[model samples]
Target chain A: MRLSKKGAAKPDPKEGADRTKDVLGGTEIRIAYKMGYVLNFYREPSFRKIEMELGITRPEIVTLIFLNFREGVTASEICEFSGHLKANISRGIIALEKKKLLRRDVDKNDNRRQRLYLTPAGRALYAKYIPALRERERAMLSCLSASERKLFEGLLDKLAEHVPHWTALDEL
Target chain B: MRLSKKGAAKPDPKEGADRTKDVLGGTEIRIAYKMGYVLNFYREPSFRKIEMELGITRPEIVTLIFLNFREGVTASEICEFSGHLKANISRGIIALEKKKLLRRDVDKNDNRRQRLYLTPAGRALYAKYIPALRERERAMLSCLSASERKLFEGLLDKLAEHVPHWTALDEL
Candidate 1:
C-alpha cells in the first residue's frame, strides 16, 4: 500500500518508486519501521511454520529455544529474555512439562523457585526445528554480500549489547 | 540471567563476559535473538508509556502510527503492514472511532470498502506522541557512530526492501 496519500509532498523520487520505502515513511520513523518490517517477516512466517509442523504455540516455541541454550533457569528469566508475558511463558512451561519436552526441579538455592530444563525429547525437537530457522536467516541475509552480512551482524551485536542500558522506561 | 548453564562449553571468552551476547546464543540464532532483544526494548517500554500517559492500547497505537503516514487505507492494509492480527486492528479502529480520533469514509472506487483517516485530534495526538518515539529511536541508535549509523540504516533499508520477496513461506 502507498505510504503517502495523494497530494502529499514527495521529496524523493527514488522513495516514491520503492513501495516498501514509502511504507516505511521518512527518516524519523524509518529505523523503527524498517526494523519492525524485517522482524515481522522473520517472526510471522516462522511462527506459522512452527505451529503447523510442530503443533506448538508461539510461546512454547520460544520456551523451547530459550531452554535449548540455557537450562536450569526460572520461567521469569525466560519471560524477561523473550519479551513474552509472564503468564504466557508460565503456560508454555506447563504445556511443555505435560508434553514431557521439559522438566522442572526445585532450585536448591531457592526452594520456592523452580528451574526449567529441556528433556532429551525437547532437545531433539529443538534440533529438528533449528535448521529451518538457520535456513530462514540465511535467506533473509542473502541480499547482502559476505562482508556486508558480517557488518550487519556486528551492528546488530552492538545494538543487542546496548539493550540493558536503555530498556527501562522510568526515565522516559 | 546467564545464557549457558554451568559446565556449558564457553567457546569465546569475550562472549562469556557479555551477558547480552551470551543470551543471543551462537550464529545459528544470534541474528533473530539480537533483533528480538532490541525490538522488545523498543516496544515494551514505549508501549507502557503510551498506555499510561495516553490510555491507548498497543494495537491502537499501531493504528495511529500507520495512519499518520498513509491515509485512506483499509484496516487490512494496516494489519498487513504492522504485522498485527486482524482482530486487534479491528478493535483498535473501533476504539479510535469511538474516541473521535479517527473517521471512516466510503471508498469512492469501491462502495463496499471503507477507508480510514485520522481526525484532526488524532493527528494532534500523533504529533504529540511522535517526538518520544523519535527520541527512543535516537537513544537506541546512539551506540553507533554517525557513519556506522548510516551503514546500519542502509542495511536495514536493504532488508526491509527485500521483505516481499521472501515473506511468503510456501517453499519453506
Candidate 2:
C-alpha cells in the first residue's frame, strides 16, 4: 500500500530531557536503534508472509510461537518473556482463542491468573510456520560472525537485566 | 505517564528468538536496533526541548546543522544526509520556517530545489543543540571500547555499503 496520508503528521518532537537521559548515550541505545530498524524491516515483510499465509498478524505469531514451548503458561509469564505489555498479549490471546488456535484457562492454583495453551490447530500452525520464521531470522542475521553474535547477545542480556519492568510486563 | 491500557496487556513469550538473534547472536542487528531506538529516544527528547524551549524537531535541527556546514544546501541533499525522506524534510522545513528558525529560498541554480539556511535564531539553537547531540552519541557508544566502537562503526558502514537502503525502510 502507498503511505497513509493521515499518518503523515510528524511524530511529536517534544519530550522531556529526563526521560531522554535514561537510555541516551549508551551502548544499549545505539544497538537498540540499529536492531529496532532491522527488526522493523524484517517484520514488515515476514508479517506480510504471515498475514497472507496463516491469517495472523506479526504479534500474534510471536505469541503463538511462545505457546509452543510453554503450554499452559500464565499471561503474566508470557508478558515477562515477550517484553510486550499485558494488553497486547491479551489481545493476541483473545484473537487466537477466537480462531481456535489456542485456549486460555483459569489457573486452578491462582484465581487471578490465566494459563494459556495451544490447541491442536495452534500446534499445526506452528509446525507449518516455524521454518519460515527461522528462515527470516537467519537471513536477517547472516551478516554476523559467530563470535560477534555471542558478544552482542551477552550485551543484550545485560541490558535486559536492567529493564526489570519491561521484562516483568512480558509476563501476563 | 502511567502505563497506557495498551501497555497493560500481557507480553509475548517468544520474543526470546528476536532478542537472542538480534543481541546474543552478535550480529549487526542488535546494534541496528539499539541505535534506532536510542537515537529516536534522544532525538525526540531533544525535539521536545526545542519545542518547549526552542521549538523544532531533529529533522529541522539536521537542516540547520547541514546548512551551517554548507550554506544554501537543497532540501533533497539535507534529506539524504539526515537519513530522512523528502516528505519529512519538507515538513521539517515548514516547521522551521514557521518558527523563523530557518528560511527556505528558491535555489538560484535550480528552481525545482529549495536551499535551506538557519536564521540567527536557528544558528543559536544549533550551537546549543549540537553539543547535546554529540554528548548523547558519545554516551550511547560508551559500552564499547574505542577500538570496538571503531570496529562496530566500520561494520555498520560496510553493511550500509552492502545495503544502502538498510536504514531507509522496513523491507529486509
Candidate 3:
C-alpha cells in the first residue's frame, strides 16, 4: 500500500490505548477528531487518482459529484450540499463548461435560475471514475462484514444530517 | 446557523430519494461521498480556529492532535497514524521544536531513536485549542443522540483502520 510503502513510518499501533486516552481527555469527543485525521489520510491519494484520471481539482470533482447525483441542480445547491465556497463552485462550473463536460441552462420558469448537468462526455468520464474510486472504498471497508457495512453507512448518514451545523456554531 | 442563513442554497430535503439513487448509480456508494463533503464542510472553521488560537496550519494542528494523545512518539509514527507525509511531519516537528512547544529526546535503549512529546507551552496551547475547535465538532453532530454518537464513533474507528487501503487498490 502507498501508505505503508516505507516501513519506517507505519503507525505504532501498540500505543493505541494511550493515544485514545490522552487525545480524548479534553474534548470528550473522539469521533470527529479521528474523522478529521483519517479523511486527511485518504485525501491525497484520492486527489492524485482523480487528477491523473480526470484532470480536475478536488473542488471541481466535488461539484461534478453533486451534479452526477442530482441533475438539474443550481450552483447554489452545490454550495449547500458540498460545502464548497460559492466562488469555487462557480469556478468549477466554468472549468467544466470550458471542458464541455458540464452545461448550465436557465430554468424555463425563471430566467435567472441556472440548472447544471453533466454532458455526454462528462457522463462518460464519470463512468470511468466509478470503478477505480469504488474499488478503493471497497478495499477500505473490506474489513467489515456486509451487516457491519450497513450499520456503518447508516451511522454516517446520521452524522451527515448535521452538515448545516458545521459552521453555524461559530455564532453561538 | 451559517449553513441555513441563506435559504436559497439549502439541499432540498425532498430530493433525498432521487439524489441517493442518481448519485449512487455512478458510484454505488454515497456514505463516503457524504462523509467527504461533510468533513470538508467543517474543516475551514476548524482551521480558522486553530490558526487563530494556536498559530498552526491544518497539518500542524493534525500533528499536535496526534501528539496530544500519544506523547513520546517518533515523527514516523505520526506519519503512520495521522497519514501525513513524512516530509511534512518532519517539517512540522522542526517548526514545533523551533517554537519550543515540543521537545524530542533520545531513547535510552536506542541511541538512534528520537521520541517527541509536548512541552508545557504545547499543553497550554492545546488547552486553548480544544474548546474552540470541539465546539465546531459538537455543532456538526448536534443532530445525533447520545447513543447514536457512540455507534457513530465506533463505526468511524472501524473505517479509519482501513486508511492504509484507501489508495492501495492499484496493486490489487
Winning candidate number (TM-score): 1
lDDT of 1 by residue, A56-102 (tens): 89889989888887788788667756788888888999999999999
| Model 2 agreement with the true structure over B118-168: per-residue lDDT tens digits | 789878877876666566555545656777665665444333232222223
Better of 1 and 3 by DockQ: 1
Candidate 1 positional error at B17, Å: 7.5
What TM-score does candidate 2 reach? 0.53
* Candidate 2 CAPRI-style tier: incorrect
Clashing pairs in 3: A23-B69
Which 10 successive residues of model 1 chain A have the least lDDT summed? Answer: A4-13
> Chain B TM-score of model 1, please?
0.83
TM-score of the second chain in candidate 2: 0.65
Interface RMSD for each predicted structure: 7.2, 10.9, 5.6
lDDT of 3 by residue, A20-123 (tens): 33433333347666776556655566666788767887668877777776688887667655666778888988999999999889988778769888999988
Error of 3 at A111 (Å): 5.8
Task: Provide per-model DockQ scores.
Answer: 0.39, 0.08, 0.34
Model 3 chain B poorest ten-residue lDDT run: B1-10
